[model samples]
Structure formats: structure tokens, C-alpha cells
Target: LLSRLYRPLRVCGVVANDGQSGGGPFWVQAPDGVVVKQIVESAQVRMDSLVYRTIIDLEFLKHVDF
Candidate 1:
């Protein structure tokens, strides 16, 4: 199985949050169904929105995707 896997993968890095606000690595799905990594900041997301709230709740409620 390992031998059959030849696709390159990019790993995202994480660190301890120190109360600082800035962009962080995130996996964003494109219109064509391609998922790309990009830096996103808290300000860029609407914390009050239902979609964002559901995503956050789901992330903690279940096993996260790698």
C-alpha cells in the first residue's frame, strides 16, 4: 500500500496560540472541488454566522480530518 502512494502532500504547521491575531493555515475548497491550503485570519470569518458556528462545533464534537 505504501508503494502505491506517490502523491505529494503538503503538511500544515500549528503552534500554541498566545492571544495574538493573525492568519493561519487553513484548507479551503475551491469551486472545482480542489482543496488548497491558505492563510486565514479570525477577522476573515464570521464568528456569529450559523455555518461558521456549526463548523466550529463539529470540529470539537468529533474527530477532526487530517
Candidate 2:
């Protein structure tokens, strides 16, 4: 089930995960057949009257053949 959803995105050579802890849990294989395990740490800091910011780029999809 996971493979089906990831296959299309993987073919494009890009993948992204967003979650608050444990990093979404998944595996990715690069176009070169190199498999990689990713673990994105969840935010663990808080500030009074402060805002945290994060930016993600989706431009890779534009270059994807599929």
C-alpha cells in the first residue's frame, strides 16, 4: 500500500514527510538504487509569544517526468 503511493513520487526522485515526532516512518530508494532511512525529529522547544517558521519547496515536482 505504501509502495503504490510512493512509487509515483519516488520516480520523480523526491519525497517529503511532515509530522510532529518520529519523522513519519518510511523508507526511500534513490534512483541510483541506494536505500536511505530518514528520521525527522519533532520540534522540542517553546518560547513565550514566539512563532516558529518552516519552509518546504515543491519545485521538484515541476521537473518530474511523471
Candidate 3:
């Protein structure tokens, strides 16, 4: 039963934000200063906040290949 249910997963590409709803790949920095890839959710972040704008302007979020 487990064998029959087993399936491989593949990531084709990232889905960009449409300004409505959706989440995709993003680079986030940890409190320890270690940057890592995370699938950030739109609801988890406030898109219209000043901090968000500052992060974008500073290029804190980066694009990376998996």
C-alpha cells in the first residue's frame, strides 16, 4: 500500500505574487544571520507595510536556484 501511494515531487518553477493571493519561493534571513530558502506565504507577510518595502528596496530577499 505504501509503495502504491508513493510518488515523487518535482518543482518546476516559482509562482510570482499577483498582488491578490499566493505564495512562492523566497530568501529569508534567520536571526543568526544565516540566509535560507523558504516558501513564504502571502498571508504570513504584510505586503503593504513599511518594513516590507524597506526589505524589498534593500534587496534583502534574494532569488536562488534549488
Residue-level lDDT tens digits of model 3 in 1-66: 475349774555664434555555667888977785677666777869998756643432443346
TM-score for each predicted model, relative to the true structure: 0.46, 0.23, 0.43
lDDT at position 50, candidate 3: 92
Candidate 1: which stretches are off by over 4 Å?
Answer: 1-16, 50-66
Window of ten residues with lowest summed lDDT in model 1:
57-66
Q: Which candidate, 1 or 2, has the higher lDDT?
A: 1
lDDT by residue (tens digit), candidate 1, 1-66: 464357776566555444466555567887877687665677777899998757644534233333
Return the clash pairs for model 2, or none. Answer: none
Question: How far is each candidate from the true structure, as Cα RMSD in Å?
Answer: 5.9, 11.7, 7.8
Off by over 4 Å in 2: 1-23, 39-66
**Distance (Å) between predicted and true CA of 47, model 1?**
2.0
Q: Which ten residues in a row have the lowest lDDT in candidate 3?
A: 56-65
Alpha carbon lDDT at 23, candidate 3: 55
List residue ranges in candidate 3 displaced over 4 A. Answer: 1-20, 50-65
Q: What's the best-to-worst order under TM-score?
A: 1, 3, 2
